[model samples]
Target: MKAYFTYSCILLVFVLQACQSNRKTETKNGGIVKYKITGKVDFNDGMQVYLQNYDNELQQFQKTTVKDGEFILEGELVSDGIYNLIVKTDYKDKDTGKKSFRITYPVFLENNCDYEFKVQKYRDGNVIQAAEIITNSEASNNLFVFEKEVAKVKQTWDTRREALSNEAAQLKASLMTIGKGEDSKYNYAIDRMREAGKESQELAKKNPREEVSSLFVNKPEHRTSLITPYLFKYITINENNYARYWTVLDSLDASIQQHPLTIAAKAKVERVKNFYEQMPVFPSITPRNIKGDSLDISKFRDSKLLIIALWSSRDRFSKMDIPTLLNKEPQLKNLGVSVIYLSVEKKFEEWETGNKSLGLGLNSYLLNVTDKDFIVNNYNVSSFPTYIWVEPKSLKIKELRGGDPATPDFLSAIKKAL
Candidate 1:
């Protein structure tokens, strides 16, 4: 009897150990996410909600159905990441008939946990009146709250901008006709615009160490103009600032750093490093002309200044920019600057056609390299219609412009380089 009792006790211990192992395995795999939408529910059963992995290169999407105003999503995330929950619905408008709309909510997700979201729809059926995360994770909740606050700040700035714009238009008309009475109003609008900029700067500085700070770093829409200067000032490559910037980046959730939205921020950090560490010389490569003759960029070292314009024919911005560069050539030539348009188009025929269509009078070359990564890495070219101004004697990149050439910012960079 004693032997049987001792064997039974040992078996029970083994069973408990097996259960603990299973639980650990499950935790290591992934977690569950439960989402519930409340308020006006006009949609039918089995309406689809998409879960998109936000940081992934493949942009993996998973779909679930809303049954009784709720859906569950389960997955294994190797690392914490930002995921998007998207819902599509259609409604009939009183005036315009039926229209379809999409609602997207971003959530920061981690493994081995469950997250719940409750979102409300407004009477308009198109607007999300409010959204709240019922999850226990404070970091995830804080990110969402911070995003909402940023949205509010942006809205206020936009309102002020519109008012100032309208007043300035009226003031311009007044100046053309009378030119005296509305000057104070115009000046007041200008002052308000400057005030709005300061407010944006202050909002960004509020949480420099948080993941939300990445939002302010390099917003593509305002990259070359509004945000770039702020980033340059804030993330300077000095010893103390560099260490602080790295610390902030390291502190972010691993997935956020890899997110598409944060690519600009990462690139900015790398740019700071490159400026301090990397060689200042441009790469030497000989590309072919329309006639298939090699035109060595190194040969242009004798010129006082060399302007290399990297563009693709398919890009809408390039269509506008190529002509602008051609038009400015005479002025550029007078200033001892020579312009070269290098086509990065995939096909030689396309390059030929685009070059002919542009009616380019300045030097032109077709990038003949089969390895696309070489050009991208060497030039640090992220987008098309990129202008790189080289000081030929040293091949040092004196100025780099990635935004619209028509902007005063780009013009100023060009002037400074000259």
Candidate 2:
């Protein structure tokens, strides 16, 4: 009886021990993973750390307190996937009293491992100092390891943009110096700046994959209407990004060009194309017009003189002059000249308003168009309110880009075209 009782006690103890071991294994794989951030930086205790998981959407996973130059970040690892951790040193500027920042290296968070982002701040006594970190990760995978990669690229872009802007401003200052006939160094500075701009552009082209504009646009959050225009602006500055800009524009245009009633994508395409026309050409088209009408540029073949006017509602000069030109419609008719208004307006309301205001002549037609392939490549309209005079008999382009007063050499080109 005593031996049987002892055997039962031993069996119960082994069962309990096995269950405890299973629980620890489960916790290690599927439960909360803890990370400790220790650094020797002289910042306030109020500093905080934020962690963002880079899935399809950047979901914030954890946050922790920065007390005594240390932080304990705890979060659940529901699955065996990689995550991105962002650590920001939150503080207020000493001089400005406004909110300031110092962020640490982004570390990749994987299951069952604690990663640290060791950062060293630049000695400069600025509100935000440059930082450097050495990590054992490749640049591509750094997306998971460091949130600062994006921020660092953004900072470098701003610095370069500011330098270019300052150089441009200095060029204007050079005119003043030259006017004074001062034997100044302004010309030399201007020459050096021009060379620097060329060098910068060459460098920008070499590493096309590293462009911030491309990275920013591809972000899932920015793949929408409101943000696309802003992205276009950034892409336009780097002419090497023409293909990147066109791909995005073409994709958006394709999605919405079918629904003429919905002006969101249509209008965006127009504005983007209009802006891009100033640069290299990448023309695309919507088969349908704003009035639910189909466009066939081939119909203009019979006219004796076809004046193609590339105008936009957003263009101040186009808005002002289109009305006057429409009022002179009778004069154009008597002279056997046909004027076609090519509107770049995106919204139906803006398009309607522009047409009604212009009151274009009997020989005129309003065709809503967008895409780089349509205007710059097909028609070669380089400037806004651009005028192209074609031989009515042959439909051959006789004059290209007759200027507006606001355009470079506007008066001279208009007189030549007329």
| lDDT leader | 1
How high a TM-score does candidate 2 get? Answer: 0.33
lDDT of 2 by residue, 271-293 (tens): 54454454422222233444555
Cα lDDT, all candidates? 0.60, 0.51
Over 4 Å off in model 2, which ranges?
1-47, 52-61, 67-69, 76-101, 104-114, 121-296, 299-358, 365-418
Q: Write the per-residue lDDT of candidate 1 for residues 1-418, one digit (tens) a residue.
A: 9999999999999997876444323322223443332322344344556667654525756676667766666655444445776766554545744345666777666543346656654445434455555654433555565567667766665676576566656655654554467778667666665665556545544443233345544333332121222233334444235555654554444334443334555566666556645634666767768777777776667777888889888998899878887887787677777777888888988888898999863378877665345657866788888887777877777555533556656544456455
For candidate 1, list the clashing residue pairs, or say none.
none
Task: Report backbone clashes per prediction.
Answer: 0, 12
Model 1 error, position 229 (Å): 21
- What lDDT score is found at residue 246 in candidate 2? 52
Provide the global lDDT of candidate 1 against the true structure: 0.60
